[model samples]
Target: MTLPRFRPRGWVAATKAAQRRHQAEAAGGPRGPAPRSQRAALYVHWPYCEKRCSYCNFNKYIPRGVDEAAVRSCLVTEAQTLLRLSGVRRVESVFFGGGTPSLASPHTVAAVLEAVAQATHLPTDAEVTLEANPTSSPGTRLAAFGTAGVNRLSIGLQSLDDAELRLLGRTHSASDALRTLAEARHLFPGRVSVDLMLGLPAQQVGPWLGQLQELLRHCDDHISLYQLSLERGTALFAQVHQGALPAPDPELAAEMYQKGRAVLQEAGFRQYEVSNFARKGALSTHNWNYWQCGQYLGVGPGAHGRFLPQGTRGHTREARIQTLEPDNWMKEVKLFGHGTRKRVPLGELELLEEVLAMGLRTDLGITHQHWEEFEPQLTLWDVFGTSKEVKELLEQGLLLLDHRGLRCSWEGLAVLDSLLLTLLPQLQEAWQQRTRALVPGG
Candidate 1:
């Protein structure tokens, strides 16, 4: 099922005006004290790749060669500028995500790390992660990257099947990926994670299980398993649309997910979040911050960051989205001294929806303490009880409410998009009414 796009949906200016009043009320009224700033995570996007994959949808560029020094310098400048803008001094983690961060020189990665260290008090025990493809480089270069201060490696080992690798347009074979995985494991030990794609056309459960078994033998502690999505404008999507390639079957995909979850569980991996499994104490800290709605700074072309922008009285939630095109982003950063193309302040209602949406994606789910940070006056019952659909879901045991707060049952997770669709409209209506009530003249 498709996820709901969390944007405005025909809500008139009245809604916007009401939301503004709601924010005011939240700041000084019964909503209690404003949330204290937390240590923000840092994201450095490396947008270049040697070759674009067929099924990929992220903002990435396949260029001949990038200006390593220029890009490195820009990343530092952008990160420092964001830190200053957000007044966020503490950094808990640094992640180098990308088209393929491995394409950049180790010196470039080191320079970025050094810049982060200089700009903020990056803890000595902070989790530093880098994304790399199997064919990024030889084991020596990967070892060099490890030496360059990257403690965690998120390798793009899309599949263990050579034929599947070809179909996915990946540059590396199964052998290459395995070799890199071994080398990375040797260097980083239990700090490496691998990404696995499921639900490919013509995929069989038996073979898929075999693939997982093979991966578990070499992987450190984490594995991100996701169903293949046919995103629009991607080569694979176009091919499926034109009937050149068959689209993934939903039934087959569900079967794959269930089996994979069971397999991972048996292998001593815990499902920390949907599509992500980890051993005890091995969760991805940077991503956990995202799920918990903690602040983060994204510095690079097409990157996105969310944080609390300082206000006269308190802090307000704001999002920063950078330019998509690499050259355009560089030009903007040069002209404006930063690459942010859009800045949006989320209203209380928007924040509530976001907190719920993202929080429910994890097994731990959202608690009262979590909700009160953004909307102290609000309660889970206030949001979920307004809808008959949610009430029905609760009665049917699809949703659970306990001392730990609201969370989806295993069944609810299976049809999460459907559940979200049922609740979102009701949530919007309730929030709209609440906002209007907060308005001065309402």
Candidate 2:
């Protein structure tokens, strides 16, 4: 379940095209009206961390010493400005994510949350979540955040095995993760999720199962189990390529995925989506909104967002994307409202790609008619899929077509990407046709 080395032709082209489009858009280039949604999600990033984990590829900065006050002020400033731009006062959810959101002092976390509440009509029961790492004593801090409107916590505990943790270059020991989780469970008494990494450079199924068993003992509301993808430009990637780290065996990793799901299901934690499992009604609202193509705004250094204006079709814009460095971010925001350099329009093809890629990982299935909506209906029936492939897949228990959309059931997900690839040519050719029609005299 590592990220594929095979980038789709469309994704590569879109990546470069998007960069160009973003530059022009930033300068107020021509664009169509954007699609609308009633309630939008918000993401506030905390870039400061006590240490830089080798495997991390996110926008993170290490502070020589804690500077909770400076970080807090920046967070508040970003939130206040974003709320003013949102227009509609009501917010559905707010997720505090990044280097270590828990590093901020409880009082600091509270003030940022408070400013958000003051500027926006956050629902009385809004789902507010703060991401925490196991190294910190976040239990004592949750009460302040709760009082300030935070109701959930997403803890990053990448592994539970001492050996694996060391290999992953994490500072927290297995005991530290376990103790902190226990304390957090006791303190918050709110929804808690623990993240785990699978298929590490040196990973084994026995340890993975033991970790899952231990994780379930706390009765966490959710679990995010991700395959260790060697992201390009990350330290891990360099190690693997330089022969300092070994590749994750594919077949062994597949076996782990199968067994891991079985173990979680036996413990009553259902696999709601790929990479995420939870008790009923405990799916991450912030993340779920992403897969559903819901509108969202991201603030702070190295954050990204997707926004659909107020009333248009197939139009979404990337807002205020920033640098990954804190010093640069501070300089940028101190001058511009966050002087961002990368904010591109995510086109319909990218949107559909996101849906297809994400939906296949969930119990949710891809609709048979997705080709019609995603690409073009005229030649879709002949191009990507035949009525037979759809019928056969449904008959074989490999897919489900429902009112919501097409979904890959638990069994179908094993071959989800492969099945979609079968129809890629049809979808691509149809997309090319439409592109030509739109750009006449080509």
Candidate 3:
């Protein structure tokens, strides 16, 4: 699904506003007491890659002669600045996402972690994850990353079939992926996770299941199975549009998804969220924080963040986006101590939309306690209980609302987009009514 684009005011205006607010709060102005200390997650984006994948549309580039030291220093500075600005006193988790963060030097990783430690309380046992490609990560490199305090490795082994790998425009061969998985397992043990893509063009159900089963034998406790999506402007999308390659089949894709879920369940892997499966004690803490709508800070180029700034009332979250281009981001950090491009406070409707969108994807769903913590002034029933659409969904066995709070049935998860479409309008109307009732002259 395509997200709505937001055109924020210029950075200079936003920066000046933020400074004024911070200064007012510091001087004990009308904003009241300082925001209570909070724990948040951290995401560091590595914007460089060795080769661009055909199906990728992330903010990454195959650069020409990058100064690694300079980039490392910029990342460190941004992390410190943002943490201070947000008044987040503790970090719950850290993720190094990328254009293959494995390409970054171990010293760079250590430096970023050290900066985080100095800025906030970084627990020794906090989950630190790094994304790696098989072509770039070897045994020695994996060992070095482990020594640098990365407790988990998310290896992008998209496929075990050489032809499929080539079609996906991945640089690593099947052998290379297997070798890297072995080496990573040796170093990180049960903390390793593998990402596999299914639903390739003309991919049959039998071969897909076979591939999944084969990987299960060698994979560690965690695996993420994703369906191939041909995003616009991607090479694969262009090929399919030009008739150079076949488009993926939606019907076949649905069949594969169901069968794949069954296969993973039989193998003792729990489908904690759509596209993610893990054994007991191997769930991704960093991603779980995201699905729970917990606050997290993003510090690298083109990274996005959501958190409550100091002195905000209630749980309203502010959205942050860093500069997209690497060099430009570094320059901005040097000038302002951060590379922030936009910092917009989310509205009530926007917050509700994000909460439902992310929370409903998980098995735990949106719990009553979580909802109250997020918005103490309103109860879950006030927002959703009176809707006829919700009643119909409950009657149709598509949704459940026991004491555990609202969640989708297995059948509902397969058609989550449609279900959300049915539910969001009701939520918006309810929220609007609440807003009107709270106003003095409504």
Candidate 4:
């Protein structure tokens, strides 16, 4: 498969902006949204890797002849700047996601952890995680990261078959991945999760299951299975563009999702989210905070965050995502202290659309009561003809009306796009009404 070879300029800017924000907060300015009743988690995106994965499109790059000490210092300053600007004292979870967190020096990891620990209101039981590529740092990176204060580790073992790995354009072979997983079991004292990808260019059902079976033999309680998506602008994407790499059929991908879920469920791993599975109480709090619409702060290059309103405005929320590149990021950090923040504007209708989009994907559906937050907006939508669409879906059993609110059934999940179209108009009307009534101007 051909890869995306063009340098991403937007990502570079975003990375710089994000780095600038972190730097600012570290220098004694307020960072993310203010802390309130609802606590927040922190996601530090370490945007450097040994090599860019062919299928990946995230903002990351291979480090060159750069000063490790300077970059490391910037990371510390950025973290501190965010703490001051946003006034976030406590953090529930701290996730170290990256091109390859394990590739980071152990001292760098320790410093980052220590910096976060000093931040306000960090949870005592904070779930600190680091995403590590199995091959980047040889054999004991997982143990090293664990020793550096990372309690949870996510190993990027995209596939368990050597042929599949090659097809996916991954660097580590299946055997190397297994050895890394074995090492992780002995090194990390907390829970460990393995990432697996299905729906490759030539993936088959039998071999995919074989991979899952093999992974189940060694995984530490949590596993996330993702369908291979050919996002635009990646190397794999270019290969598809040139007709060199084949795409996964949507129907086949759906079938694979079902199979993976069944196997993991049988292995005692429950599907907590669409792509996540875990044992009892093992679901990732950091990720669950997202599904539940909880708050968080994003740091480093290309990280995303959500901050909800506090006190009287507690029901409302806001969100932001950092810039994408790493070099631009370090420069910005040196200049402004933290990356720039792009606040995502949200409205009542958009919120419902978003809530439904994320909430429906999980096993636990959103409750009807939460809809009341936008209840003031839903009047005219009630008068519209589209109201019948909801009734029609209810009559057809495509959705359920239990105490957990409206949720798509297993069959309905397949036709969610169609369903959303029918509900969008009502949602839009409701949003306008709510804004007019509740917002100051209306």
Top TM-score hit: 3
Q: Count the backbone clashes (under 3 Å) in each candidate.
A: 0, 7, 0, 41
Alpha carbon lDDT of each predicted model: 0.80, 0.68, 0.84, 0.69
Q: Give me the runs in candidate 3 sitting further than 4 Å from their true place.
A: 1-37, 312-315
User: Model 3 compared with the native: what TM-score?
Assistant: 0.90
Model 4 residue 188 lDDT score? 61
**Least well predicted 10-residue stretch by lDDT in candidate 2:** 1-10
lDDT of 3 by residue, 144-171 (tens): 6776778899999989899999999999
Model 3: weakest 10-residue lDDT segment is 1-10
lDDT of 1 by residue, 1-442 (tens): 1111112221232233334433443554332222347469999999988788999999998876577667877887788778887777678888999988887766666666666666655665678899988887578777667666678999999899999999889999999999999998899888888999999977888898889999988888999998998899888899889998788888988888888888888988878788799996788999999989888888999999998765423336788899889888888777776799998887767777888888888888889788888787767778775567788988998788667778888777767777788776776887777878999987
Question: What's the CA RMSD for each of the models?
Answer: 11.6, 11.3, 9.2, 7.9
Question: Local error of candidate 4 at 275, Å?
Answer: 1.3
lDDT of 2 by residue, 193-301 (tens): 8898888886878878888888787756788888888888777788888999888777777888889888888878868787788886788877877766666777777
Lowest summed lDDT over 10 consecutive residues: which window, candidate 1? 1-10
* Model 2: how far residue 282 lies from native, Å: 1.8
List the lowest-lDDT window of 10 residues for candidate 4: 1-10
| Model 4, residue 132: C-alpha shift (Å) | 1.0
| Model 4: residues with Cα > 4 Å off, grouped in runs | 1-38, 137-139, 308-318, 369-386, 413-418, 433-442
- RMSD to the native, candidate 3? 9.2
Model 4: residue 118 alpha-carbon error in angstroms: 1.7
